[model samples]
Target chain A: MSQFFTAAVLTSTVAAGIALATPFLLAALGETLGQRSGVINLGVDGIMLLAAFATYYVALRTDDVLLAILAGMGTGLLMGVVTAAVSVTLKAEQGISGIGVYLFGLGFSDLLFQKLVGTPLPITTPPQVGIPLLDQIPVLGGMFFDQSPLVYLAFLLVPVVAFVLNHTTYGLKIRAAGENPAAADSLGVSVARIRWSTVLLGCTFAGLAGASLLLYDGIFQVNLTQSEGFIAVALVYFGAWRPSGVMAGSLLYGLVGAIILTWKSLGIIPLSGSDLAATAPAVITVLALLFVARRFRQPAALGKPYEREA
Target chain B: MQRPVHRRALPALLAVAALVAAACGSSSSPAPVSSAAAPASVAPAASSSVTPAPAATAPASAAAAASGATSATTLKVALVAPSAVNDLAFTQSMVEALNSIKARYNLQVAISDNQFVVSTAANVIRSYASQGYNLVIAHGSQYGSTLQQLAPQFPNVSFAWGTAGSTFNQPNIFAYQANSNEGGYVQGAMAAMLSTSKVLGVIGPIAVGDAKLYVDGFCAGAKSVDPTISCIPVYTGSFSDVSLFATAAKTFVSNKADVLTGTAQAVVGAIGVARADNLPWFGTQWTQVSLAPHNVVSSQIYNWAPILEQIITEIRGGKLGGATYTVTLGNGGETIQFNSGFNLPANVKAKADELIKGITDGLVNVPQ
Candidate 1:
């Protein structure tokens, strides 16, 4: 048992877990804010993909990680705006529009990946910065301080988001608009503007999440994130529509991801003939979704199409 | 009433049209061409290139003997690679080999990249066949199933699929794999020799038939080198996932494996972690010495060029008709590259050289 929890192994495992969690956490937190406004933006996944590919292209060309990250965020903002235009402004069927966004992003990004980087090209990312004193702390040092600043920022955003949603006037209006848009509109809240802003901000988070995935990690592949967007969607429900709950959920998923790594690393789980271990995250996410279903409470107007006229 | 009068005339016109269509279908097999006319007529340019010409245009027997049975002046060969042609390794080797044949036989060649998909294979084959290409080479195991199904559809064209000889047996379908297992086996042997501990590890892609071949040969090669050696093998089920690869690499390190090898296209992740951990590593498909400048001790290189060159030359000479052709070290098909860019110890290099010579001299055979 002690061997399983050895200092070196445990530290590295936690480091890796955090690395894996960064993308999901970033996207889920963003979606949480979007959902609070009663807009279920399934387009988060598509937005992340466009950002991931755009990040790869910019990073490869400019060799500037910051510029590449900005490119990803820019793409994400565009995706958000498009989704906002269709679902929030036009009051289109939110679910169908979201699905359309997903399909378009998946196929279009793949075409882009093929066009830009037809073969594997070497990529170098900015070095991860270690916080001075925090990085020196034995086990915690490697786990928390050893990560890229993006990982720290993902965790930090959770509290900041929670504060905004729970304490700010903007947060109260978003809740009112999501629950009863007519009430908020009659109160001169500009329901359309609030939803659009939330959608854009949510997608900006998603774009940064995607940038973390591409530049923070060593290399890139076409459609590499696979269905991580869906995983982010599931995280929103599992968190029960709260920023704090969402972070806890992300940590739960991240821990499961870590366990799979440790188990396979320690040879606790025997891999028969193939590399099925990589599918562990998807399996774990599905099982978590099943466990959390009994407690799910969706917003009342989550998917309802709003209209000005009766 | 006026419309009803015109309906009778419309049926009469339709009946005449149907009669003509039925007559055309029954009188001749409407397959665009009759079997009575040999395929040679479909591409008169193709048959004329190989046939004896007028005395004035004919080259002397000396030129014919110099090139070894060059009946065809131009053997049009089409090659389809599943990956990019400029990989500078696996795909590049095949393309380079084809270029050599093109240079030698003055062969008219068409090379298209399938870019790793089964759907792309059929289209590439069809496009090349329609252009009257004499030989089509589908390079990659994924193309095996599709090429087998597509081979008979174009009888005038012959195909050579790479990485699996399973497609062989159809007269027009040929298969070639430059003995990848032999290369895998050599890598395994090198891993065993390089390991400080008696344990070694191999991480490969999901076990398709080809992957299983590499795994089995690797185990055989490792055990052959040291009887007490323990070989740990795992698969990540994907060809390009870095996180999964990192997990596998850490697992190898945890198991006291001083040396690790992986066959993932994205094995750089494994190699990166291995280098960071200061363990020796081996790789397959490409010379990835640069990936882990500190830990990648060697690689089992797939030089598919020779096999492609051989197939093209044989098809041009009217002598290459087999369901499959297997080439090994005995045929100079694959090579094991050992470079000290990984900062390998002097003894390790010496042992690697001995093994290289042994394999070359037929004294040591990395098991099939």
Candidate 2:
């Protein structure tokens, strides 16, 4: 424990936490957008898994990072389109349709992987780039600025998401749709369009997150996302459906996870105690949710499909 | 949407997430490592006296029996495994060993694969015992306690389990271990020489059972090569969580580890990092070249056939159980299979061979 407090260990652990938080932040921020626009994608995990596999395959075949990223986002966008078709246009129950998407993503990705890449193979990873002067800072810059570009993008999107949700006219329309779809529709805000747009964006972010997982080590396997998509979904509630809150929740999770991993590595936490400690993040999430659940309100029209008056 | 009013929406979402997480967690094995398992085949009947068990009765064993040349004296063997039979790691070693002895011993094998949950596994173990299977093998050390309880209840039945050297003082129990340290020590000695930075990373499932011994031996071996060599071991506390394994590997790389090695099936994740970083990886449990052909230096292959052969011979000699067997390099139970594709330096290979010979001939001691 004393050694864990040393600057070297602390910085490295914190740095690890930040790196680990990238995928969750991206995915959760996407969830925040969808939920604020009267949509919830339960199949986020599925979208991630499918995109992860696609990202790995493309990277393996092309060795083009941009093309691989686009391919992954394309997969997510395609899945998002299908999800919108079911939940937005067809008015299927959002929860059930999301599960269907998740199942599809889970099964089809593995099937494709086995059919295409029978064994594990490595791909070219995106190069790590450090911010010029920020990386030069003694310890802080190294922890915060030195990472894959995806990490910077993920963190930068937190504020971008907040601005879009809190300030833009489109953001107002999104808020209206989630709070009262009938009113948003009556006001000619096009609830369907707003919901469609948000869900697509949410899923594309999920795709980016998935692609980054592959980009991390250039490896893709069965269940690559490991259901991180679902955790992101839950994080939406943890953040009170706000972008900043979601970012906080993601970092909290990552930090807690990193701490545990470090402690185990340092032998501060015994192997027997590690399992119990591993559950800390979820336990913390639940407690935090329970504490905040009563304070913040979910969008009134969230998870409901709207049909305009004929 | 309003049906779950604002007050309850959070709880509702939590419930949905919980359900999704539960679904993911309930997988029989940890990951897709077992996706390549051979279709369960039945033993062939060698004589008119051989009768296959009904498919509805014990399907897996029935298939094994149907595929074998089963005779009247054939032994009914059941394997209770925590993962898929072809997981390419621990369970695969035992399955391969069992397959090797099928012809000589006339064993009718049944496998209950992916028994990770102890309660469910206990039920399957009980099922095998009640079916009067001549031999029941609980292949995970996690099942030791349950086996100890079950072994006494089924006194007439013979049982075996391992990567452990304990029979729980039960006369009807057989225990086995790979003494994996011998091979791990050799791998570590080679890794130390291979490293230019003199820093090494190890990914472990948990520090217990065979995992602890192998890691301890590895650290000792590296230090023996050069006392100043830095070899760090990190346990992800899971045998199947691939993401955690990857994270551990990244941490090591960030801390300047030049070479990597790990145990368990999930080590594929670490191997990926090693491949991406172009670092050599020493693998254990099985030959992992298929995962990272270029990165894998070599692997410590656990060949349990000889030990299985010994146990079978002993059992056939009127010994029900009460034996603990350790597979050693000298005993022909473990082999260091170097990857042919890897461009290892001549001196490194020679050093590895020298280390192997030393351990085999009992000239070099592996730290316990």
Candidate 3:
């Protein structure tokens, strides 16, 4: 309806939609790379949280945004490696191990925040920077062009990820490992190394997603990544496990978020029904999963742990 | 020997390196909390002196008091709330209050935000207890049952909470209740008088006990003023979803409602709708009027600083936790703050002032 789909509403919706999608896009794209190397990281959410709280503390202590982001990435990489070592080397269940990593990261990061900042502190975040010409264009300008640099990176990552996965030799080896670890191992490829590296790379992206949220929101509150990790998981499936598809998925989710925000901003949708629209991303992801399940095939050894015993 | 050297030292070195790298990262600097609180007893002193209130940063006095009361070397306090510490409204206020107390009194405080997960509640308590926390305070009404169960095991540690008239019997556990409904009633009275259309709407999160107090108090306050006023209420059953709050607000505005009030945290969405539609609204807990300066008529502000400072002072003093302390209008626990810049009608201000006096005097009872 024109009432819901007004130009102002659409543009704002797209902007907010992208903002909401950055975390999911970054996490899912990272996961896609990991899965390609036969490593499934369910701990993406936990890793994001670890990065978020760590970044918050570091930023609070040092007042450096770049350092915070790097800290987040490093935390994510460590979490990824832990999950990878247990699942890839020890042959532990990937899903279970990833869950453990998530739980640990959440509790550990939260404790660190409590210890450092003393529960709640009034901290001010950096202002978002925009390019000169693009940021001033009415609706799209403020929404798309005048965003935090991480949002643009999320979009840039889609093609970069596609190029890496589809064209690069490392990408080929990762795919080979995911498709048939034993065959790849027979070819003298260290399946363990590939899986560990992929998971760490994915975790770094996940960490970036967490950083985007804290940096953009201007404050780091508790449960800062509430269900965002689940959304990232959903994006992986929504994108049909492809980098381009994941980007589309993030856009769709971000679009819904932006629409609800814009519609409310314009007084188009009544306030009572706005919560339903907020549920749109999660619901759409579920529905998209159903569609993808029927249309596409998941990697053969997606969740199975790789062991060298045989 | 070679394997042992790589295994033992490398991971330790990496961990240390990671810790150093992490220590260097992050953005945003916090303002020093010198002016965050002005003691309740003191007059508005000089403008720029960063003196935190006596209730907030009286560590020397608290230390003297604690030494007189107990021999405990470390005073540990834990915060377990239904929502995250960054909720920015109810829970955030509590967290800030507790942290201020901790900083002033030099008490060790641990906070568990999403302890809304029932399984995690007991686990969190046990972990904190194992670490020898002296006092634990749970923020939401939902944690009443959880606190009751855990208080016995950690008898040496005191547990306190804000619940709906819920009490803990353990020598160590206490409850803290506030005159929240009184604040709700004031907003109601304000919204009732300010409405141009005499039709008001409320978009609440859920139909819970505390939320019901807000809704019922608002309705009662409105009815006390205008016998012929119509009030609409809707519970969307969620707090985090802002779009829903907005949609409800738009509907109310579209339906000729000129005033709105709600208990939903995401009610910011609803306020945005009100601002865009040019209808005045009221908020709760924090000064949400800052969101839409023109549209927000008034906010019922809750002063957690007083309650927090008092509890911390009492602990530092010779007193073991008292049976639940309930703050009322007479005690300056809660008050309705109007946008002083807004030129509200004289009659409206007079009626609100009269009601506040009556409430403080116990002549008027706000419905809960």
Candidate 1 lDDT tens digits, A204-297: 9999988887764455554556567778888988888888777877777776666665665455667672346657767776787778767776
Candidate 2 residue B36 Cα shift, in angstroms, is 15
Find the candidate with the highest DockQ and give its number: 2
What are the per-residue Cα lDDT tens digits for candidate 2 across B153-267?
Answer: 9998889888777889888888888778888898888889988888888888877888888887888888888889877687876776677787788777766688899887677
lDDT of every model, 2 decimals? 0.68, 0.78, 0.67
Task: Give a tens-digit lDDT track for model 3, residues B233-313.
Answer: 766556644545655564456455788888745665666667656677777765665566777777766566555555554
List residue ranges in candidate 2 displaced over 4 A. Answer: A1-12, A89-100, A132-134, A263-277, A283-287, A305-310, B1-88, B91-139, B143-161, B165-175, B193-198, B227-229, B307-325, B340-351, B363-365
Ranking by DockQ: 2, 1, 3
Candidate 3 regions with alpha-carbon error over 4 angstroms: A1-5, A129-138, A260-278, A308-310, B1-80, B83-114, B122-139, B144-162, B165-327, B335-368
lDDT at residue A178 of model 2 (Cα atoms): 93
Each model's backbone clash number? 5, 11, 23
TM-score of 1: 0.77
DockQ of 1: 0.11
Q: Kindly list the per-residue Cα lDDT of model 3 for residues A189-296, writing each as its tens digit.
A: 888788888887898998888777666553454456766776787778777778998888887876665554445434455545755655665687688778876787
**Candidate 3 lDDT for residue B91:** 69
lDDT of 1 by residue, B1-368 (tens): 00222323344334334423432331111121111112221221121112111211223233334335453355677777754454434565677666644554556666665245568567767777778878877777777777767777877688887677565467677676556677677777767777778887777766665556677677777887897887757776666566567666765676577888877455766776676677887776767766556677777766555555444444554533454555555555556777667666677567667766777678986665
